[model samples]
Target: MESQQEIKVIKSSGKRAKFSLTKLRSSLKRCGADDHMIDKIVNSVRDELYQGISTKEIYNRAYAMLKKEKHVYASKYKLKKAIYELGPTGFPFEKFVSTILNYSGYKVVLDQQVEGKCVTHEIDVVATKNEKQILVECKFHSEEGRNCDVKIPLYIHSRFQDILLQSTAEETKPQECWVVTNTRFTKDALQYGSCVGLYLLSWDYPINDGLKDRIDRLGLYPITVLSLLSNREKQFLLSRNVVPCRQLIGDQFYLDHLGVSQERQEKIMTEINLLANL
Candidate 1:
């Protein structure tokens, strides 16, 4: 085992922390690397590990190494970047959110308008499961270090109040409001959300059940993560709101539409299948 004290790594937040070999191994394993591959990759990464290295560099090194062994796992490892590439606009991210809700057994409607007492509020996503309904506001950030602040929850809560007032006037049950972000919430935002009974889902919040966790748990990775797919190809698919990798499993028409050749399509399918099995 490499001594953690021997190396310090810079985080996305610009904080320095002791390097963790366990975390390095776990990250690869989570992306469906086999035990043998994990061991090999870790040993390779360990040799390259040094003080003052940025996490981004470390990730790139590991991803490049993984790509040599298995393109599918390499693609799976790019979850964070894949998600960021979802948009400069939050529209695609909202669709991704809806997909997650659908996978969790909710019937989802995107960009829906609900009549509030004052005016109609356009909700990013509205999901219903069983007897419960949730109105979600999706906040997406393409860059790291951007957090959803308390103002978002506060504004959302105000809108919910108007919605509740309208619902009460019509004798309808009020829908619960949730704040979902692709990144994370500020400390004050989380505190305010909890105090007001607002549900929040962010990249790493909620511990074992955060947005990233849920995606990994379902193996519902975005097709953009496929290493074989060029950025332009991925953007072409994303332009049409095609997000999930599994959606391409048997959809040759869509593959052709995205301009993927027969040869490339076969490779894409192979990777997709490998990811699904993982």
Candidate 2:
């Protein structure tokens, strides 16, 4: 048991907390790591521990160690931070949502303005699967601690109702509404959603069926998770709408256009191949 004075980690929120090997080990386990791999990576991270280390630094170390052991698990290990890197704004998040929905057998329309009974509302995404139509609102928070609250559900419910009222029977066929976020939902928000039958998808809500689960089930990771890229590079790629590593797999022209140096570009492609198993 290391005391708080022994080691500290700077969190993504810019807050500091005492480093705990237990917590790190638990996180690896949650990422579906096996016992043997978990022990090895935990020991590796422990050996490199120091006071005032950034959580990102600790994570990268663990990720590198884990990647050598199991590439898929290593990719999943960075899920949380990868999600955070999806935004300073929610556009990338929306694109991610679209991708997930598309993968899930839904035809998706992004950032469309649909006419409600009273007004025209700019819907974040519209996903239609078979005969079921889903209106999706993606609520993305850049920071970890903040969550989607009751007010958001209430607001979305109103818009959903408005859309339901305005649309023809054919247009609203088997309609549903979903609010998805990269973080968790507030207690009240979850409660409200349950009461209203509004589908809510967050990072860890609904047990094994949350956003992370859905992403992992399909192995549809965002481009931000590429460990070889820096924050600035990731953001730049996102800004240009290059939001999936698969998009860069064989596209050397795009890499060159982005001005990624030849050596670094090779490193990135190699990493993407490992993560995507391409």
Candidate 3:
């Protein structure tokens, strides 16, 4: 019979080793496992693994271990918990709104809280362009469920009132309200939004196309260009006293005239290139 150490080494080597129960047992032991934990981990790994598992298979095994036993070790449970905590589903709803608005030549302000009668509400993102403010509310849902009918209308009504009050006498009133949801809205919600001139944006709209076209025709390049700027670049611009311009111009003129100073323009291009590489 092979020595335990030799068996351990052979079982744990190569991509093919991932399928071996002997390898899992050895790994659990190496990690300082008690017998009960070793058995549990080995069984879990054995059940989930097949031939040709990669090194990154740890995550898959850890996730499966957590789901199998509700009362699993904290370390195992954390593997799945961390996924939900850091998942795009949690906060990227807001990010998605910002991306679309930035593409469409609008400046985004995030998480602005508004106080209203009988309730206090928060707007996920509010976009300003050419003196026209567009209110955006972002929702992330597991499915296209009933909130489309109930929550969306109530949300629109509340935002409509608050936006009206927030407008200054000189500033142009918000021309439209936007609800950007991860899931598609029901038929009734779409009709309601259309009736009130609320622009509903969804995943179906190509982010680059909508933005580029608007920038081309309306000379809304400032909005489109600023949208492309990184959070750091935007901050740098603000620190230097750059502000959003409302003047109407063609795309080519806006790019040549107002996009940036020669030095700052080079910096912006470098940043965009780096982000593209990433």
Candidate No. with top TM-score = 1
Off by over 4 Å in 3: 1-89, 115-120, 143-147, 165-173, 205-278
> What overall lDDT goes with each candidate model?
0.85, 0.83, 0.48
Score candidate 1 by lDDT.
Answer: 0.85
Which of the two candidates, 1 or 2, achieves a greater TM-score against the reference? 1
Work out how many backbone clashes candidate 3 has.
1
lDDT of prediction 2 = 0.83
Q: Every model's Cα RMSD, please?
A: 2.2, 3.9, 17.5
Model 3, 16-118: lDDT tens digits are 3313456556544432346886677765555545444454465457545533443222222222122122223435436534754676678998888755444
Give residue 183's error in model 2 in angstroms: 0.5
Backbone clashes per model, in order?
0, 0, 1
TM-score preference between candidates 2 and 3, better one: 2
Using lDDT as the measure, the top candidate is 1
TM-score, candidate 1, is: 0.92
User: Which 10 consecutive residues of model 1 have the lowest summed lDDT?
Assistant: 166-175
Model 1 Cα lDDT, one tens digit per residue, 1-278: 44656788998778888889898888898888999999988887788777788999989988998899889789878888889989888888898889989988999999988998899999999888876888999999988767899999999999998889788543255558989998889899999999999999998889999987998888788887899988888888888778888777756578888677899888888888777674
**Which prediction has more favorable lDDT, 1 or 2?**
1
